[model samples]
Target: MGSSSRRNTMSDVTIIGLGPMGSTLARTLLKNGTNVTVWNRTREKAEQLIREGAEFNPEAAAAVSASPIVIVCVANYEASHNILGSHEVAKNLEGRLVVELSTGTPQDARNSETRVREQGADYLDGAILATPAQIGMPDTPIFLSGSEAAFRRSEPVLKILAGNLIYMGEAVGAASAWDLATLATTFGAMFGFFHGSRILESEGYRVDSFGSMMADISPVLGQMIKYEGEIIQTGAYENPQSSVKTCRGTADLWLKQALEAGINNEFPTFAMGLFNKAKAAGYENEELAAVMKVLR
Candidate 1:
């Protein structure tokens, strides 16, 4: 039988808060043939999942208690606390696995782990790196961190949700820290790309034509990221293939071009500022990875 057809023997999962991501999680689970119980403050939000064979519980405690693993994806840690930490809910969570997937500060993740552990429940804190639309795909990265015991128990279900399930060790905040770092890069790339596109548009160039050139960046970004991992982790910024000086020259050209095009140079200028700072710190001759040291 296919995996979904044999879901009856698999561990049941409960999803709390039928927000966009939460609802997506519930639907993914149901579609893949997993027994699911879902709860949301607004009953209408979970109506679809309910109709799709997911058990809909009006009471949060009932939803949580129905499954071995209860996943909470809400506004943030505060909202999760208010819902899960309630007397009725808290009392029922003992010995269960609580997976917190809400985005929050590392401190929030740590605090939630402590509070949930105090309630006699095993906790795993997670940060989903993909959009809700990408939730069930294998290639989506999900960073999870917490006690090893808790992780071992949840691994099977996690694998079902993500192709890339990164367990960030036993520290509760590691997943959140990595999640924030990933978001920083993602947001930076977003702004940086748009800034350049705008600069081109200002020069009477078609944005559609610029897209073909933009597609060429994938390999460059991939290589840089791979090199950064090898270089930064070992603190080896020496004997450069591409020196900081060369990169700064490129960034300066970008900043100057943006300025000459009468477009906002803020994005390129900000990047140039970093390159300038790195050069000023005497890393001009070092590999471009040395810029990371200045950032530190």
Candidate 2:
């Protein structure tokens, strides 16, 4: 801790990396009356925030020392390591809380925690589930996992950026794990939508209308996913409302349609391959979720 006068002048938090997301975080915190200290590799990037009443620290080590909580929103773990991995800067981490918002693997999170803790600092691995524009909103989500005590200490400040805080317990890697899993689910649907759009285009139908329809019936789609997850979790693949054979029929139809329309069939081909594996395993008559068995 610094002297009384120095502490009085210090910001509540120091934000590293002045990228769009980092700038948004600083702006949001300033908007909410939280004193903010900002730093970036490019000094020009900190100019706008300085005009908005943010204090600019030219050095990464000094910037981190200016606040009790430091939030690093850089490009990735590699960039983060390049900045804070230095012995000089890492030394300044003592008696502070470090929140890493950079995206990386679960192992990255674990390694980050080890490094920060080795410097006598508390660390929280965080994953922002919302976009820059979504920051500071009450419903905007952020997932965090780390030392429970550290999380408790940082919760109020973290909630200032994202009110919907999902604390995934003390496992530092949990936040990144959840982020990657959610990304997989989201991108998988996006790829499916790409193929679906092709299907609509092939039929001379409006793809935007199909998207609107998906939005309208998203709850029903969500329910189907939930049911399948339950089936997979419970290892229950019997008495299916929709069997593997029936689901495979839809994949066949997609492939047939794609062939007839002279369109790409990559998505359907992938699905057919999985379903075919299940069929080979004698699960054609089982629930659609039995595909997991083949996958496992």
Candidate 3:
């Protein structure tokens, strides 16, 4: 095998794509004293990093061949495939590790893992839960999944790019699945907040005060998350105390007001649907946790 031209060193890393996130990763690696080689479809995008002591490669295959750990942060799975799927590049990737930080579905991540494994390379699917600015910070959360060996081998490099690095087991698809689900939930809540704030603004209510109230009440969502597990596991919605019917009625009234205030009720409407379904399922006297039945 002619000694497999790719070099493996604790300080060697290569990054494909030079978008904000990709560029940030490159800079972080470089700042941490890692030798970084970067490539982008548009060559000029790598200019900034070049000035930061990063080696710029004009060819994608050469970039992949430059290091043991190759990180890709492209636009999508297809773009990721385009760079790593080439015959020459794939052959050169043998015994190397590919860490994909691209935004994609679980299926996409799994499929990429399969392809990379076929090339005798290691694959790790990663999801960055923070923005570009958060890269290299201590609190940036990066979810990783794939082979345990691959994850452990690349931990040092990955840590340079994230504040908090989490391993989500060995299934490459797990990270992507969890990432997408979390993204949907976060955006849903933000959209609901925006709708409420706009309605209050229209009625001459101070948006700042509403924002403060939301900040204070946001902890309740965390409580709901903690209680959700108990509700699901025991199938017990006994709010011991509170009645589901009362909660349902209150939610319905809230939804109606949302609609009447010229605010979009889609968010609250969706919640109401679940609440109503649970109530109809003979859980009216149960606690609000009974709504899990509808959610399930």
Model 1, global lDDT: 0.86
Instruction: Give candidate 1 misplaced runs (Cα > 4 Å).
Output: 1-11
- Candidate closer to the true structure by lDDT (higher is better), 1 or 3: 1
Mind giving the per-residue lDDT tens digits that candidate 2 earns over 108-159? 9999999889999999999999999999999999999999998999898899
Instruction: Report residue 88 deviation for candidate 3 (angstroms).
Output: 2.3
Off by over 4 Å in 2: 1-8
TM-scores, one per candidate: 0.88, 0.95, 0.88
lDDT of 2: 0.92
Worst 10 residues of 3 by lDDT: 1-10
Stretches of candidate 3 exceeding 4 Å from the true structure: 1-11, 240-244
Task: Give the lowest summed-lDDT range of ten residues in model 1.
Answer: 1-10
- How well does candidate 1 score on lDDT at residue 204? 80
Give the alpha carbon lDDT tens digit for every residue of 72-161 in model 3. 999999999998998878888898999999999999999999999999999999999999888898989999999999999999889889
